[model samples]
Target: MRNNRPMSFPRQQARTRRFTIGVPRAFQISPDGRRVAFLRGRDGEDAAACLWIRDVDSGAEHVVADPRTVGAGEEDLPAEERARRERLRETGAGIVSYTVDDAFARAVFTLSGRLYAVDLDGGAAPWEVPAAVAPVVDPAISPRGTAAAYVSGGALHVVGLDGGGDRVLAEPEGPGTSWGLAEFIAAEEMSRFRGLWWAPDGSAVLAARVDDAPVARWTIADPASPEAAAQTVAYPAAGTPNAEVRLAVLDLDGDGVAEPRWIDWDREALPYLARAGWTGPAAGGPAGGAGSGARQDVVFTAQSRDQRTLRLFRADPRTCEVREVLAETDGTWVEIMPGVPAFTASGDLVWIGRGGDREGARRVLLVGGREAGPPEGAYLRGVADVDGERVLYSASPAGCPGDVELWLFDAHRGTSTPVRVPPPSPGGDAADGTGEDAGGVLSGRMRGGTLIVQRRDMDTDGVRTVVLRAADGGEPDGGTAAAAGGIESLAQVPDLPRPRVRFWSAGERGIPAALVLPSWYDADSGVRLPVLMDPYGGPHAQRVMRSRSAYLTSQWFADQGFAVLIADGRGTPGISVEWEQAVRGDLAEPVLEDQVAALHDAGKRFGFLDPDRVAVRGWSFGGYLAALAVLRRPEVFHAAVAGAPVTDWHLYDTHYTERYLGTPQQHADDYTRSSALESWGTVNRPLMLIHGLADDNVVFAHTQRLSSALLAAGRSHTVLPLSGITHMASEETTAENLLLLQVEFLHRSLGGAAGVQEAPKGAGGV
Candidate 1:
């Protein structure tokens, strides 16, 4: 039930943005694996997200596109599709994403900022392309499904699909330039949310221009609209000036607006482009220059603005030359690996590097550069799809760094395996009906031999999906294998209770922890309870994972009676690349010493934990490690809430604060040993801080410069702000009264074991 009164787990995890609205997510299969597509919500309180498809031999699930049947009700989007759905933390709302045609016979997307498309073999009704251009950001669909490429108002258009060729190809040559979107350090720290790509014979696109007039602007305001005007933002932060980003190609088999061909490099020594596209003509390499043999080439990867050199070029879209096939250096940075500059439909070169040295490094993958599978000591994580010579990826094994799984690989049998799911028919409890065990946290896709997958564990609560394939000509039913099924999750769930977590490998560098408790805690009733921790604990992300929606809001803060814990420790990630470069130059002491060593090793192996009623909460680098665990361990955290925190690593963002503190102008003591305003007059506990007066990623000037350095060191705390929030307090009554005012200020600053009660004064900020 989406809610029928009596639904509090912070209002069903903020009306399910956390349980992720109706769960089926961006799948997209169809290269002859009989159609698949995805995106969900016709339930689980449906906050928009429609698209659908599914028919692998009559499993039928259609609904092609329905932003309320294309009238696009009340979405008025476009500040570049609301900053590309706030840089893809995409809190759903109608077709959150799409883009299909590589003969997946058509699909596009975008609703409020226009453009629609739709035709995956027609059951029609999705028109509005009218040659796009009404704010359409990040479209794509052009493997010759006759033209699409998007991004408006900062130009790079190319329309054509029966709206009579709308063409602008690349505009914005001044005022914070732009051309094909994605800037703000390549979509918030290099996950590279595309600037544009297209050419496997859609005759060319490549893109990315970005300028942001040498960044650093900031502002935001609307502190409850004093007649509202503020906004500004170019931002960059930490050793400032970033948004220059270049790259080019253009041509769309041209007749007008064509002239681009740029693609140079050494952009002041690799200023983070981090990945671009095209190897097409089915990945068979070599072209455009050096004999212009042309089987499709472009490929990209840039990085090093002290991201310790990532480089992987190959370019040549008709002699805008490039070359460097592989580089990867590191003394401390280079991590940008997700799906990689891939290829392998026999054109080899599928890359992801760094193997053992700086504190035993190891993340291999590569396919033509060799060392295939995520073998020897696993932990890889990222690659998740190549699909012709296979690949797939995702990792976390060498001693289960919290179970992420998925595997596949193949490149013509240099083997890899581990994909699972096919179990249910003998008893029918899980090809989706939730018997889980494709182990925890998987994800997938694949083509022709089908696959799909999905998963999430701690024995499932939301996400399941499945699919599989290969059983069409009547297979030997218990021998030749292949034939799973199941995709139906309408998400909801967390009408709380049933979390009682535990997971282990806690202290002495085994770190990975979990804890959670209070599903009516009675660990043999020793009754101690009152700790909380809940870290994001830094580096990319992972808050103790083996999924059950990652402990539904840490078991709704352990059913609100404390004892939560969580942790990943040493600079996070699936536990490698030297455990995410151990916060390279200290983003605050080994992440507040592994959340104070997993809260004193879970208060010495669960003796019902109270560790002096600790408390720590987070958001963004776990709200800078819950305000650095009460300004650097207030005798191991007596209280803190911190949401949107980055209490100044020089106000964040420069390819993630210069890949772990390097440019706060040449590591001003690693930004003063990771500034929680260099321990602002040691505010002894009960912190608070909440920020987000429109955060453009950790902005609100980092909780107004740590609440003006804790009121100029007179130290007391508690701030809140919020007006027009971002940095995902995904709204809904400020994510349900910021979890009921941080468990009523951790039970009024841990004075009484927060046995939770008082939570109604002005709720939580706007």
Candidate 2:
């Protein structure tokens, strides 16, 4: 219930800056809703993100050991020594952070390359699991919470909560080890990093093994020693032969050790393991009759290379046998499955697939029948329901942003009645012209004949707990009476405000954008605020309107009254692959033109936009775009911040860098034309460049090369080289300090009312 009046209020004087930036990142709530884990980060040249766990009921808290604190305790490291250590560590840092999201289990864990478990009760110290295991990441805990499974050294491993037995399940075969199963690479490329799954009885584990030995390897040099030599990196680009994938199950039969048995997925199948998980009991068969008198089921989806043809298999862990239950192929590439398929406790499979002949238009399907001919494109948007009797999904028919209707269909009954459910409007944009909305049951469970749905919104910004009757009739359980009103507006700003994302049209096609408004907004006053625009500008990618990220300080600056915009310019995902490849050849031209147009369009439509006070910022490839925007369209933005930006694509890796922009040798002119280094002479704005000396992603040379040219051109700018932070800095202390600098720089140039003093900085700011 919001005020409907559109009245305006008078201008007010500035107050103390009491705004929170960042989001409740890696947000996790224990299965029973008794505990939570999240990361609090800082803005600086090198970001420092720290982990914290809290009791959901009592609000008690404890700080997980920070990886940045490894080896050196607080106050122990002088600048130079710390830098040296950080550089060496960056070369191969394992899991420096772990987030727990165990809905089926109560106890949760956290690790900074080290395992530790915490009790769900009040204040408790995290018990460290003493082991130097290859950084256990992506812990997939069993529904019973007795054991957790994860990937290490390209093999699957499982650890118990009671301590003791911790052993590898799928060890690499013979001489040729897993091509590259290390951190960073696995987490970035393959969707699943710590790949491990639990059988229904929790007696076995299923995992994905990536054999990337056949891939081409290229070595990159340390930015500090660019001309010294090169270090090798095994990378496989699109169309190139990918790592052979295999599936195996670890039978942990009470002996506290995992027995590996490979499951036949047919290598010639050439299928990408898009989604896989242990199916629940029911659905009948041997899978439902594993050890411990418990029923166990396994399900996995494999999509072929061209992204067409999806094969779904149901496995019985007892016999290590896989039964191909469903398969679908399309003339055009079949739409990517809408995330992993949901398995009901009754063993009913639910998922979202496409057939409407257009992107963004998909249908909800309950995979009951075997023959799949263009899945039931009837019901629209959806979220996978792991255990729902009917296929429940979220849908809004082209004009509503967050007004999602929860539809339930009983394929058995052939009925498609939608259960009326209310959704928060992430933004009040009508669902017309490519505008997108997000909603779903955060996590729900059937307790005492009642269904509890935890609902949250990207629009209104908060989590609401609601209970519904099991029969969908009568008053909800506990006489709650449907919560007075289903929707409850939570705090947009907690200790750290969730990133505030909004959707607005910037260019032609009225494209959608995941924009963030400033934290300290004066909706009543009609004063245009400065803007910080970030455009991802890549393929199959999007900056969706969602909560803030741990690595971003967009809200912090917004807290200082500057609007931050992250628009998914034309070439980005969320639209179509056709739209994605449109700007492939054009390169920087399309992104730069669209964003600049957006600035003016935003200013004209929203009077609160200070068009002249806008600043552009990005990192990596995004940094390349940011540099281009300020250099090419200096009039659109007043300042620019590019961190570890790709000044020249020729120096980047072969896979992603060359995909859209051919080879540097083939398209020499395009490379030169699109590169920021070539246009450094035209960068007239107040540009601030930041890069980690040990960065291997875009490499420090990108900045080093550009800085030299800037100096030769006598263009004044600020350059800061972080000692050891890589492309993406995860340390909270460092990130916070970097954000503090961003705020100071933005405030100084944009003339915004500021509060906090500048954070301390180390050497190297030219």
Candidate 3:
């Protein structure tokens, strides 16, 4: 239970970093199920995350490595590492991620650009890897556990676990060329974070070589620190030339030297390297072979620049031969999902496919493929793990868009069903054990017979994790009784008021929404409260979900005297393919229409919402939507706070923006129609634009251009420029005060009680 004490919501939100500072994540369950390793902060307020492992037998936890003890400071990150973390929106400190070997005996990670390895079985202190280069990034231990591969100085290097024979496997061929690293678009938009993948046998590696020479360069300078030189970045804006990405098969020998064999593919046609990985022996090729063995299959997925066609290919690393396995095409765009183009243990290809005649849902298809599950409303999100006979995945079933449940499909039995792992009750007992329903959004990973299940819902303050063993009857059997219990969460208790959330569907499209009323509000008092519509309302994200923590900020705003409504209409994920594609060709119209529809419908159902006093607030895509609401539909939205909004589609990236809006040259009108810059003249509300000057994703120029247009149109608006923030308002003081400022602005703009004092001196611009 949380401490029932008064605290500043904004301060707590900042201190705890939105309740994510100490949460355990990036879980890796050992194949033998004896141990589970994760990264978490030492305490809720602790920013530096440490690597910890839990013993499945005795339920004991061991701190494998602590940055504080290792003499590594989070502030010592390399420039490349800092940029990578920024792309990932990772704000935490210390060991944020690590990779283990196949046997789970060795784990390798880079802390402050120094490579370190820990002996999982020996309980020894982590030691630095002997590298020719001092700074390292993305250290991955080979599957056999004898060697590790990492990137340094834009080159890939490998070292033996015995601390000898460290050598550069691949070096840059040209000025802007780098090996074993994801390109900007691949990392920023495609969600394929890694640039290299190891072979199952550890004998070879499939690596990507990136050339950024053709991409346009943009300089970001710190205006406050005039003495520092500006940093230049390769930014591939819409319609601009992208980084040249290619894959190579690097064969390694015992001497730590690698010979690269370039894989042949039509780089001009399929330019985007969406995904690349190695599937185990089940993906058969040659039997009883050594180098390009029959057991290991090198697979990759590539998409055209327009993103309308995606092709999956399997390659022979020994010969650098490639064969297309599957190809998908759509007129609008083909979606690239995570954990797909995988092979089941028996050599069957597994992937997530768009809707077919059998069902109007995104489903798992086994290649030569047939739908693995029942053709219904179950929208497959991603594959978690694939064992010999079973595939584990996450999906949202019928009428449960807010809840994602773990499901398993037995390839042998041809049965797909939800995995019913018991959830922990408030008292920490099994929900079933206490005769209560375990209702929540569930996600899990399976290894051998062990399963690690994580559950989060509106009823809980934090995520609950449980480990279970599979029984012969195909049900969860409590493994070592003590170890089988819910894993103790070291996350800090957010001592904040519980959200009074009401989940419902609104509008004709059945847009999912959650309406949060003030805890002290009396429904029968006949007081119509002002409304605040908060929504991301875009593709790849959902604002309304089953997690309680997802509503914390919205609830805080509600407690500040407004009814907060979050909606996920068309273009938001977790519905059908059609729902997600609704915004294609024109990113603005349908999304804004859905938000408008959801607002009106929710106001009609929830009598306490005052439509005339409604305000909208958001960041990123939501920020764009907020600005759109006031500029184009001021009659519906009275005021807005748009933070880091995308003012023009041409300024965005190729992979993300081109997928929806097409090329600016080809579809000039579409970009013109979708951009907020074109509609600035219609603004008739108290609009405030907030942007971080250091943001590279949605650059500060977005806000600057919009503010300039508004000023030219003689429209009244405010622009708040954050001097040193990025896409994420991660700075503690800035994040806390930003929320307070938003509340103060809303209260003043919406005719409520004047709240906080004026904004800090230099925070505002015009």
Candidate 4:
């Protein structure tokens, strides 16, 4: 959420609203469709995460019992105690949230690596199922909703729905099961945290077992607690040994834990199982006719570390055998492409690929070398079949508006063919392309011989369940009216303005951003306005994608006539692993280059933008980016507002810092080049920095060093350390004041009409 908007913002046009804590997160629709489960957490110090379920139709809400019986974080404590706790939880609340309703809904939430289930019908408090010790994270229910599977305490597990029991099905063999190690290697390297999956019939679970026992663990003093003891976290820095990962399947039954069938791969090969799940049994059995026990094996992707090689492996659960049907490799890195389209009732596996010919080398590969596969002597981007024999898969590049494509693959022949799915009707900006925008999450199901694909269009802000009948075209399930309304309400957050996705090109990546234009904006009128470019430049930590920030802040920016931009540059998540890892050892270059490019691009494209009127801003890692953007590219930006930024990696906490930039001792040059404190003299742009004096994540020393270095370099900059403001703010006033100060900085430096604005009144928030 953008921090400051004037009263004229779009939200203000509707109504003035009271401040509220806790925006809903981890929203999960129940299997019965009668209820929606969500993780409800507080904001700032007043914030702590808790499980809460709501009646989808009635809007009734109930707080799921907390295992620690810690009532809503600060809400359960006294005033003085609340204030004290706020100080501790600001940097981060070590709380775990959940979403049940997958095939296995038995194990709902995870607490400190342990599994727990809450009654959907509202019975006793949450009960802990101690089958494992570590966090049973990212639990996936089977397609029939009988078993829930998760990665816990460095092992894969399955729990029965009818209160049968929980069992450890598979643990990384040999060196994979080291103590104090985080879960899978994919979760760390590829950043795919949910490391396991449930099959369609709940008969088997496909899991990614990562072995990182060889990687070294780094220690960092807890940033949230200076007087508190130091805490060590496992950090696999760049070029360091990463966890070796593999894919395995466990037999799921009411019987005891079945043996794990390892997918056949070279033992020396570090093959990453990026995606896995059963495609239901092969349609029509061996002869393409329906057969009860004739389900085809599950399909998974075996990728290499640099992400160069990809092999599609098909494994039969009954036989416990695996075979590589299709293989693709790249000298640089091959993108197996995450979030591929789902399969149809006809057993066609539609997915996106980047190599081959057909669409012409130039036309096929767009940003970051992405393109459709070779066509009839051509290529396709939206669809392709990795295992097709002749015409394995086809693609719809042009007609398919959204970034997602529809494909049909014949497993036996190993060929792919694209299916022409109708585009969303001409409405408010239809779903266009898969690139970085358009597609949110695609959920598909086969029913009554119809392959129904549920596409959530980020562009249209709508979700449609399209039904493709018998390989032929059919009407969408939700239809027009219901689909439109559901899409709107699903994204229509209460007391906030709808977010917009903005794009700009940086280096080889098409950097994407979410923008909230000022509510008072007049497009036709050439009114040069101030802008705030907020970014989070950490590796895989994308802040712009559907994130709920403090109290209607974007509305505040809109009201104030400041164009708020949240850019997910090269290193940000939601893109690819190569794009994310590229920032390693060169953190500031990719991010700084992108911010400058975006600022200039915005000015050139939008007539209302003031060429000289731009301010860069962010918090934590974002704050670090803001400091670097202005200092490194002072020509593009006028001012900067950095909140709790890590001025130098050498002095910051080791775990997170070293993970991206490596140890200061190992990559001394990169650490020095990426550090703002080392180049404080270049910070000639107008700078207004605010930080929590008690921030542990980014020690107050970061600000102190920046303040001192700027002074020594003879560079003038403003500094404000919010008293009692920990690294994070809980109360509304904290965010409000932050926005207020930020807007003031933008006004002074970006040529906001002098004397045109009055001082912001009232405390920042409640």
Q: What clash count goes with each model?
A: 5, 36, 3, 67
Candidate 4 yields a Cα-based lDDT of 0.51
- Evaluate all candidate structures by whole-model CA lDDT and list the values in order: 0.75, 0.52, 0.79, 0.51
Clashing pairs in 3: 281-295, 286-294, 366-369
Sliding window of 10 residues with minimal summed lDDT for model 2? 8-17
- Residue 483 Cα positional deviation in candidate 3, in Å, after optimal superposition: 8.2
- Worst 10-residue lDDT window for candidate 3 reads 282-291
Return the TM-score for each candidate structure: 0.33, 0.64, 0.93, 0.61
Local distance difference test, candidate 1: 0.75
Q: How accurate is candidate 3 locally (lDDT)?
A: 0.79
- Between candidates 2 and 3, which one is better according to lDDT? 3
**Candidate 2 root-mean-square deviation in Å:** 9.7
RMSD for each of the candidates: 24.0, 9.7, 4.3, 9.4
